[model samples]
Target: MTGRENRRGRSRCREPQQSNHDVCVVPEEVSAHEGKPLYVLVALWCLKRGGWVNRGQIADAFGISERSATFQLTYLSRKKEQICCELRKVKRAGVPVESYEVRVTEVSPEAGVRKVSEKQREAVKTIQRGRVGNADGDVRELTRNIWNSLQRGRKA
Candidate 1:
């Protein structure tokens, strides 16, 4: 079987030919964050495809649910300044689909600095202040305190 054909002999989704210029440069902030790696993968996939990609296409390519694909696309849309893409609502075959136009050729490290709100900053500060030590007892205490605060409807 050829690379274009699956085991069942069905042709795979046509991806654009990759050239040297077709590169997805992930920024340090994206690489360092948890759960963002999937975002990076989706970005890279869209970049290589070089056109409007629908949620179903993303889901099939990544082996994820359509809802999860939508979430990834939505998150990427919010990072448009860093990823150099835009989200569009378009109809394909009379079905409305959420699509992303991947126009990113390269990304600089400086573009990855996400704007954090004052509330987010304060939350980070609170977590940092709560970290007394790396010992097992300290870690357990911190977790318990966070759980308790969450149960009490307070910010952890």
Candidate 2:
């Protein structure tokens, strides 16, 4: 066995892992950029993980400062319906850590976002069928009614 392997246990995987996930490594091409390119990498990571991905993992994978990682993550987190970024309390190695997750899609309804109910779904279907050159309802009133129907539920 190598001296380093002897010093550290062989079972210790060098790859960063959280829960059951192996963190994705940033591509060498990706590591070379500072702005939008890094943003793409962050987005890809979020999409791949399909849940919350942490900053330390991104930093280590890309050999970047956690600050840079945070900047990139925060940038992508702003695009609604595309990416959602939020701070969450998480336990890492049994210690609580403030973590961020960039969700590519909304798994849960966020604040200021509404969920559609049976009524809204029915309204939407009616709207779709009526939209084929038969839109007789006042646009403003129809919009308000649809909006109200969507916001009246807890995503059942």
Candidate 3:
């Protein structure tokens, strides 16, 4: 029997070879963020791939809707300086699409950290200051307060 064949005479399926670039090194901070884990992960994925990642690719990789992926990409593009990525809008097969290219393979300690404005900080404080009582009414009031605070912040 040939070395390539197993005892049953069927050829073994070989695993696809991977280059050094296929190895993705995720930083602690990327996964540490309570929020925006998908955004950070998509950035790292783009960096590891070293190419333009479209919304469909992001959606496939993260198991999210294409719109959600686009939103994350848009957010990253807006914060390109903080995230170290580049965004390009191009037409694929005559359909306009957005793609992201990560500028760095390695993430810095401060990467992806957004600077909170004082107004946003005050809003957070106001939400946190609400008392959490055992009563259902108290919980509803707290929820309403948080929702109102968010709406006010959005309007400002």
Q: Highest lDDT: give the candidate number.
A: 1
Off by over 4 Å in 1: 1-36, 94-156
Question: Model 3: per-residue lDDT, tens digit, 33-92?
Answer: 324344666676667677777877776555466777778788667655557766665655
Writing each residue's lDDT as its tens digit, candidate 2 over 39-65 gives 565665565566767777777655567
For candidate 1, lDDT tens digit of each residue in 1-156? 113433444323223233422212232223333233456657766777777787877777654677777787886777756677766666558657435433435443435356799999999877756556667987788899998988889643
Clashing pairs in 1: none
Evaluate model 2: give its TM-score: 0.38
lDDT of each: 0.58, 0.54, 0.57
Q: Point out where model 2 deviates above 4 Å.
A: 1-36, 81-87, 91-97, 106-156
- Which should have the higher TM-score, number 1 or number 3? 3
TM-score for predicted model 1 compared with the true structure: 0.44
Model with the higher TM-score, candidate 2 or 3: 3
What residue runs in model 3 are displaced by over 4 Å at the alpha carbon? 1-36, 94-106, 112-156
How does residue 112 of candidate 1 score in lDDT?
Answer: 37
